[model samples]
Target: MTGAALAVALGSTGLVAVGTPAAYAVTPSDEVAKLPIASFGAMVVDDAHERVYVTDGRRSSGESAVLVYNFQGQRVGSLPTDQPVSGMALSADGATLHVSQSHRMLTFDTATQTRSGASFVPYDVTCGRDVAVAGGKTWFTETPYNDPYCDRPDNIASLYGVSGTSHVNTGWQSQGRLKLAAGPGAPDRLVVGQAAAGADANPFLTTYDASGETLVRGPQRRFADAEGKGALDLKDIAQSADGKRIAVADGAYGTRLLDASDLSDAAAAYQPLPDGAKSTAVAFSGDGTYVARGAAASGSTPDLLIQPADPANGTTPLEFAFEGELDGLRVAPRGLGWSKDGTRLFAVTSNGNGGLWLHVIKPPAAQHDSRFTGALGTTPAKPVVGEPLGIRGRLELDGPAPAEPVKVTAVRKDADGTQEVAAAKVAADGTFTVLDVPDRLGEATYTLRFLGDVTHRPAEDVTVTVDVAKAPTAVELTAPAEATRTGGVEITGKLTGQGRALPSGIGLKVTRTDRFGTTGELTSASVAADGAFRVRDLPSKRGKTVYEVSYAGDALHSGSSARATVKITG
Candidate 1:
């Protein structure tokens, strides 16, 4: 009877309905720092120097500086850049941080936070630049125009490469701006995604082999279903430490996990964010232990989450719900960064004012394990179609008690295909019940899962199959032995049904067969609340006649029949 979680069902409508369990920290926020300006472009964490750098993309911030902080969020120092800074990246060796400015790519030493050198980009930067380091060089996106022409296909948004004090134009062109991503071991892996500012309806996302002399295009993709429902709204793209998987932060869709080889949807996807929360940024930690998802949202809904990188693992993420002015509202785009060891995470948040805050968090390194005990059982021994059914089971956790109760998610697969059940709450006693109504007769299977939390590891799935039977319904009849031809004969019957009440005012199908072996249709008898019905028929020929009553089954009931015979006198 004791449980800590709330019960909320995913309505039969298939809309997502997440229960708001109390939020508990996997680990408390280590530090919070106020940024020099609210304007943010991106963040990069330097594990080698034990520092983190954040860029201020405000072109009018006067003298913009790359704000620097220690791993603990203590303000270490700032490297003053002549112009506003935007996208940033660190070298494979982690010795230098590459930052993009209006017309130049600047380099700074992570060890001393000092500006080292700069290379001029070929074009006049207007839409700003996105920078990344791969194949032992720096790559960036360039847009030549300064006004509303940024989205023009003629504007010729291009990619440029920088190495050894030389700026080499890659000659790759697109209608709009491009976003770039490359990590420590992914030198050969360079990703460019389109952001057309509304011009390009179907923007392309392509990967390149930065390892070779000429950039070789790898897997390329542009998404739009047959009905054109899912379109890519690219915000950020991150590669796993091993460079096998790519996670795209899609505003139109939730976080998309894609295989880096072909850019296809991964086998399993992370559970959706609470409704109304759009993906703003996504990144994998350097060690590949966790993946962080940032979103812009309100209230108790999460604005940031850190979970396992393997979607198939289904671990509940360590959640962060950013509320009012005390700590910014939501995570800014490209606001997430992690230390190489996956021990420290940096999140940038905006307060809607001209203010920004940096948060430092440490996630649990190891998870407490969990398992579901006891065989699954239903309240009623046998279930009938169209009736509420409850499948009960118990979940046990190995570690200390959870900060809040956990929940178990389930899916029901029947003749109608698969449907998600409303999540069930795990009681303090580890007991929870999966509730659903079987819509079809035959066998249905329910699969229950526990995507573990910061406190626990994911449990193996348990399945239970159920047999559903049609509801029973019958027709009862009462008749007179004989009747005169002058008075029409009246036949009476009652209809009874089981499982949810049969609808009122139902008509039973009736037919009459004469002694001559000719059959004819008769007016149907309407059944009342009391299940009583009567119908009259006059025999054209004086002979024996048979009246047959039948009730065809509905969605949940089986059909039944009744018959009566009468002899007529002339």
Candidate 2:
């Protein structure tokens, strides 16, 4: 199921937890900082030093700098660059940071925050490049040519491995911009994907065994279906903590989870993103327990989701909707990174106005148990079809109360099929009422669920079966006590039903019994929109006459009849 949306409130240095009631006061645990750069390029986290490095990717030959921040979201320092900063990666030991530049690859000492070394690259690239620390060496990709031509499909791009004073061209080349992803879990493995900006009808993604002296390509994949639909629109990619799975954020397809070994679809995949959201960034926690998926969404739609790394886990994701001036509205592409302990997530966002923001979030350390403790009770005792019924139940949550009340979702299963009922909000006391109007008769079962939140585990589902009976209907007749034989007897009646409104155009059955004890059928009377009907008849024999009006009920109503006597005189 899609996770619930939580709107985060940003302060100068803190972020208040969402998903709680507005009236509840909350302690700010997360951090948010306004980025100084106008454009976002990449974000790298050094868990050892608790520092985050973010770069400005906009092409500029004049001057650029990598903004640095601590785990607390405070600006710690900056690394000045003669040229624009592009892709960046942190060394496995967290001792060095590799930064990509137009004419060189610069390395920074994480401890001293100073340039450790600089290696010359073969190409002076005006277009930004991608850097990754893989195969026991530093590798980067170059899109030959300058700014405008960077995204051109005809541009040639190549991968190079960095050595002592220069870089080594791996001789592997492709058209347009190429992306690279490598992590501590898969240090010797390099995952690469092509950008759709290259005008490739179908983009390709492949893996390389970087452990050897030379780059060996393995398991290549092209994502176009047979009908030429569903081509890959890659945004960001990441490898699981164990390197057993790879997750790709495709704007056209949401998040695609695949087996890392062969790039095949994983047995299980994460749920579809919220509507109107486009995938932008993805990252796996260093500890392999969580994966953060980011998207470009507007309004209250979530732009970031933190959930279990294992797709099969049913735990609900912790969602964050970033929509504030201090916090960017959407996540930037390739803007997510996590600390080694899987405790903090670093994300970069752009507000579409050239403004960028950085957020450091800490997930809850523990999840408490929640359960439905007692049997559900329904209002009105006896449930009738077409009538509103409230299912009352109590939920026991073991943890602290949520800022906002939690909701309980329910579904009704009947002969016709299953139907979803509106969610019921749980009060502070852990009591809730699920209201639904049963449309079908006979046995109907209501199943209520409480999908867990970030701090609470899911509660065991509880169900209640009910026997639904049809609504009762009645016919009321009004007739004169006496009528001359020469004058035709006229009778007025009304038809009404409990629960749902009675249908219009109801034809009531009418019969007349004369003094001779013989009965004859009269013309049926059509009911008006107000449930009123009229019946008129002329008796051939003048004497005491009985008039009976009856209605045959429909599926949701029970039948009923009424009678009236009129004396006829000559």
Best by lDDT: 2
lDDT of 1 by residue, 1-570 (tens): 011111121221222333454444334445677787758887888888898888876644246788889999889888888778887889888899998887778898877678888887764444667888888878888877465455564566888899667688787888767889987657778999986534447777889999877688898998867766677888888999888889999988979899888998888777776678889999899898899999988876778877888876555666677775656888888889999999888989886777788888777767788999989999676988878889999999997877667778888888888887777779999999988877789999988877676668768889999899888888888888988778978988889887778887688899988889899888888888898999898878678988899998787888999889988888
**Compared with the true structure, what per-residue lDDT tens digits does model 2 show for residues 39-149?**
888889988899999988887687788999999889989998888889999888989999988888999999999999999996645678888988889999988655466
In candidate 1, position 470 carries an lDDT of 89
- For all candidates, the clash counts are 4, 4
Model 1 accuracy (lDDT, Cα): 0.79
CA RMSD per model (angstroms)? 8.6, 5.5
Report the error of model 1 at residue 218, Å. Answer: 2.8
Q: Name the regions of candidate 2 deviating beyond 4 angstroms.
A: 1-28, 196-200, 477-493, 510-526, 533-548, 563-570
Residue pairs with backbone atoms closer than 3 Å in model 2 (clashes): 20-403, 20-404, 21-403, 21-404
